[model samples]
Each structure stands twice: as C-alpha cells, then as structure tokens.
Target: MDPINKEGTPKTPTVIFDADKGKVEIRGRSIPENSIEFYKPLVDWLDRYADEAKGNTEVNIQLEYFNTSSSKCILDVFKKLEAVHKKEGREVVINWYYEEDDEDMLEAGEDYQSILKIPFKMIEIQE
Candidate 1:
C-alpha cells in the first residue's frame, strides 16, 4: 500500500503502511471536516493488509486529538485489526502513543486496551 502523504493539514497526521515491513503508522490530529471520508480508505487498506500480513504486524497510532466521529472510526479500525488477530491468529502489536501531558489521550488508549485482546502498548511521546 502506498503511504498516505500529508496534505496541508498541519496538525493532521499521516499514515504509512509498509507491506514489506508489516507495519503501519498513523500520527496526527484526526478532527477532519469529514472524518469518515478520511478513515474509510484506511480501513480498506488495513483489511487488505490483514489478508496477507503474517508473522508480526504493528500498528502505531499517535494522535494528539480526534473528534467524536473520528473516535468511532478509530474504534472500528481497531475492531478490524482485532478480527485479523482472532481469525488469522497474526501476532499484532498496537502501540498507542500520546504526549506526556495528554492524560486524556492515554486514558482513551487504556479504555481501548480493556476492550481488545491484542497487545496494546501505551506509550508517552515527547512533544
């Protein structure tokens, strides 16, 4: 999959999916005007990747903030990943990174961790 290039949303994050490396990284503010429009393709990409991804798969998320719609979409993304893990039994690692002062974001990750079985690693990223 081609890496998602940043398109003028300074605070908005970019997405990189490395098929060869079995890694995907999403980092940015996800409060897009049309959240679904932004995330649908990501969901599609992940779905396709899950089909062939083997051994280890890592999805690293570093979002400073997101809207309610974006939150729902993010949950969907994780759910899809969870399905891949359960069905394919892929070794998946989710590293959720938040700023040191962003307790709210960290807590959000914690909440997601509680709901999913995949290894959710909460990390503090220095701004």
Candidate 2:
C-alpha cells in the first residue's frame, strides 16, 4: 500500500503512514475545520493496512494541540489500530509524545491508553 504523506498545516497535522516500514506518524496541531473529513482517508488507509500488516506496527503521535472534534477522530484512529492488534493478532505499539511541561497532553495519552488495549509508550520531549 502507498504511504499517506500529508504536509502539516496550521490547521492540521502531518501524516506519514508507511506501509513498507509498518510505521505511522502524526505530528503537529490538529484543529481542522472538518475533523472527520480530514481523518477519513487516514482511517481508511489503516483499514487497508490491517490486512497486510507486518509483525509490529508502530504509531507515533506527537500533537501539540488538538480540538474536541479532532480528539474523537484521534480515538477513531486508535480504535482501528486496536482492531488490527486484537483481531489480527498483530502487535501494535503507540508512542505518544508530549512536551515536557504539558500535563494535559500526557493525561490525554493516558486516557487513550486506558481506552485501548494496545501497548503505549509515553514519551516526553523537551520544548
């Protein structure tokens, strides 16, 4: 499957979904006007990737800030990955990165970890 490479804009995040490497990265702010529309293709890509997923898929999410709508879309993305990990029995690892002083972002990652069954690595980066 072709990689999903989207440049990050002020209103959206940069998405790099590399099927060959079995790695997906989403970085930057996600406050798009239409969150669902912005994330539909990504969700679809994950669905397709599920079928041909490799041994372990790594998802790195480093978002500085995101709106409420984007939060739900992010959850949807996680759910898709969760299915790929559970039903397909493929190992899915999520590396959730946040700035060193951002408590909210850290809590958000914890929340996602609680909601999903996949393994999560909380990474703290210096600003």
Candidate 3:
C-alpha cells in the first residue's frame, strides 16, 4: 500500500505511515481543527495494513503538544495498532519520545502506555 506522508502545519503534525517498511511516525503539534478528518486516512491505512502487516511494526510518536480533540484521535490510532498486535498477532512496538524537560509529554506517554496493551518505549530526548 502507498504510504501517507503529510507535512506538518501549525495546526497539524507530520505523519509518515509506511507499510512496506513496517514503520509509522507522527511528529510535531497536533491541534487540527477537525481531528477526525485529519486522522481518518491514517486510520483507514492501518485497517488495510493489518491485512498484510510486517513481522514487526515500529511506531514513533514525537509530539510537542496536542489538543483535547486530537487526544481521542491519537487513542483511536493506537487502538488500531493494538488490534494489529492482538487480533493479528503481529509484533508492534511504540516509541514515545518526549523532551527531557517536558513532564506533560512524558505523562501523556505513560497514560497511553497504561491504557494500551502494546509495548511502549519511553524515550527521553534532549530539548
């Protein structure tokens, strides 16, 4: 399947979903006016990717900030990944990168880790 490569604007994040490489990445701020609309294609791509998924899928999420609406959409994306791991029995690893001084981002990663069954690696990066 073709990958989704979206450039980040002030209101959105850069998204890179490459099924061939079994890698997905989202970086930058996510505060789109319509979160669902902005994230729908990615969700759909995941649905299709589940059919022909790789042995191991790596997800890298590096976000500086996200609004309330984007949070739910982010969770939805994770849920899709969870299904790939659980129902499909595919290996999925999430790398949640947060700046060293960003407590909120670290906590957000923790919260998602607590909620999702997939393994998450909390990576602390220099600001």
Candidate 4:
C-alpha cells in the first residue's frame, strides 16, 4: 500500500507512515481545528495495514505538544496499532519521544502505555 506522508505546520504534526518499512513516525505539534478530520486518513490506513502488516512494526511519536482533541485521536491511532499486536499477532513497538525535562510529555506516554496493550518505549531526547 502507498505511504501516508504529511508535512508539519504550526498547528499540525508531520506524519510518515510507511508500510513497506514497517515504520510510522509522527512529530511536531498537533492542534488542528478538526482533530478527527486530520487523523481520519491515518486511522483508515492503519485499518488496511493491520491486515497486511510486517512481522515487526515500529512507531515513533515525538510530539512536542498536542491539545485535548488531538490526544484522543492519538489514542485512536494507538488502539489501531494495538490491534495489529493483539489480534494479528504482529510485534508492535511505540517509541514515545519527549524532551529530557518534559515531565508532562513523559507522563502522557506513560498514560498511553498503561491504556494500550502494545509495548511502549519511553525515549527522552535533548531539548
């Protein structure tokens, strides 16, 4: 399937979902006017990718900030990935990147980890 690549803007994040490489990366800020609309295509793509996913899938999420609405959409994305792991039996790992001193971001990752069945690796990067 074709990949989903979107450039980041002041209010949106960059999204790169490559099925061939079994990798997905989301970075930057996400505060779009319509969070659901912004993430719908991604959810649809994951639905398709779930059936034909690789043995291993890696997701890197490095968002500096996201609003409440985006947070739910992000969780939806994670739920889709979780299905690939739980139902399809594929190995899925999510690398949640946060600044070294961004406790809130780290906590957000921890919250997601607690909610999802997929494995999550908390990665702290330099600010």
Candidate 5:
C-alpha cells in the first residue's frame, strides 16, 4: 500500500514496509487528532505482513513525540510483532531509535523492551 499523504501540513507519521531493505519504519510525530485513524491501517498492514513476513524484519520506530493513545497503539504494535516472532519464529528485530541524549525517549524504549521478549535494540542518533 502507498504511504498516507497529507499536503499543506506536516505529513502524518508513516509505517513503511521497505521491500528492498526488508525493513519497516514508523517515523514522525504521532499525536494526530485521531489516534485510531492514524494507526489503524498501519496496524492492519503489520498484521498482513507478519503472516507471510520474509527475512529479517526490522521494525524501526523513531518518533519525536506521541500522545498517550499513541503509546497504547505502540504497545499493540509491539504485541503484534511479539506474536509474529512466537508464531512463525521470524527474525524480528525492533530498533527503537531516538535522538542522542534524549533520556525520555531512551527510557520509553527501555520500558517497551522490558515488556517485549523480542531482541530490541535502542539506537541513539544525531537529531
């Protein structure tokens, strides 16, 4: 599916399944007006991809900020990944990237990582 596009305003965060790189990236601010609306299709896409998901599926989440609703949705997304890992035993890796020196973001990643059994890597990058 094509990435969701909105012009004349900031583009909504996107969850892109890159066929070439065999990776998925969810990047941007996620405090949309409707959290469900923003995340529904992406969740569905993850559900579909996880079924026949091929080789080293890397889920890259780099969000500058997200609301409480987005946090719940994020957990749901992680749960889905965990299920895929358990069910099919795929090489699922969750790379939670954040700006270097961003303690809040780093701590958030740690929180999720603790809950998920998948091999999660916290990546610190230049903002």
Candidate 6:
C-alpha cells in the first residue's frame, strides 16, 4: 500500500505512515480545525495495514500541542494500532517523545499508556 505523508502546517502535524519501513510517525502540533477529517485517512491506512503487517511496527508521536478534538482522533489512531497488536497479533511499539520540561506531554503519554494495551515508551528529550 502507498504510504501517507503530509507536511505539517501551523494548525496540523506532519504525518509519515510508511508501511514498508514498518514505521509511523506524527510530529509537530495537532490543532487542526477539523481533527476528524485530518485523521481519517491515517486511521483508514492503519486499518488496511493491520491486514498485512510485517515485523515490529514502531509508532513515534511527538506533538508539542493538540486540541481536544485532535486528542480523540489521536486515540482513534492508537485504537487502530491496538487492533493490529491484539487481534492481529503484531508487535506494536509506541514511542511518545516529549521535552523534559513538558509535564503535560509526559502526563499525556502516561494517560494514553494507561488506556491502551500496547507497549509504550515515554522518551524525554532535552528542550
């Protein structure tokens, strides 16, 4: 399947969903006006990828900020990956990166980790 790549704008995030590389990354801010529209394709792609997933899949999420709607969309993305990990029996790893000083981001990662069954690594980087 073709990969999904979108450049980040001030209101959105940069998305790189490369199935061939078994890597999916979402970086930058995610405060799109319509989060559902912005993330639908990503969710769809993950659904398709679940059917023919290869080795371990690594998901890197580094968001400086995101709105409430975007948060739900992000959860949808995680849920899709969870399906792959649970129902499909694929190894899915989530690396949630945040700046050392960003307590909100750290807590956000922890919250998601608590809600999802997938393994998540909270990576702290120097700001």
1 versus 2: better lDDT goes to: 2
lDDT per model vs. reference? 0.81, 0.94, 0.93, 0.94, 0.76, 0.93
Candidate 5 global TM-score: 0.84
Once fitted onto the true fold, the runs of candidate 5 whose alpha carbons sit more than 4 angstroms away are: 1-11, 19-21
Alpha-carbon deviation at 64 in model 6, angstroms: 0.5
Quantify how close model 6 is to the true structure by its C-alpha RMSD in Å.
1.0
Scored by lDDT, the top model is: 4
Residues 1-127 of candidate 2 have per-residue lDDT tens digits of 9999999999999999998998999999999989999999999999998888877899999999999999999999999899888865588999999999999999999999999898999999987
Candidate 4 lDDT over 1-127, as tens digits, reads 9999899999999999999999999999999989999999999999999998977899999999999999999999999999898865589999999999999999999999999888999999986
Query: What pairs collide in candidate 6?
Result: none
Q: Tally clashing residue pairs in candidate 5.
A: 0
Name the better of 5 and 6 by TM-score.
6
lDDT per residue, candidate 5, 1-83, as tens digits? Answer: 34333221253576676544557788888786777887777677678767766666778888888778888888888887887
Supply candidate 2's per-residue lDDT for 126. 88
- The CA lDDT at 106 in model 5 is 93
lDDT of 4: 0.94
In terms of lDDT, the poorest run of 10 residues in model 1 is 3-12
* All candidates: TM-score: 0.87, 0.96, 0.96, 0.97, 0.84, 0.96
Query: Runs in model 1 with CA error above 4 Å?
Result: 1-8, 87-89
- Residue pairs clashing, model 5: none
- Model 4 CA lDDT for position 73: 98
Pairs in steric clash, model 1? 13-28
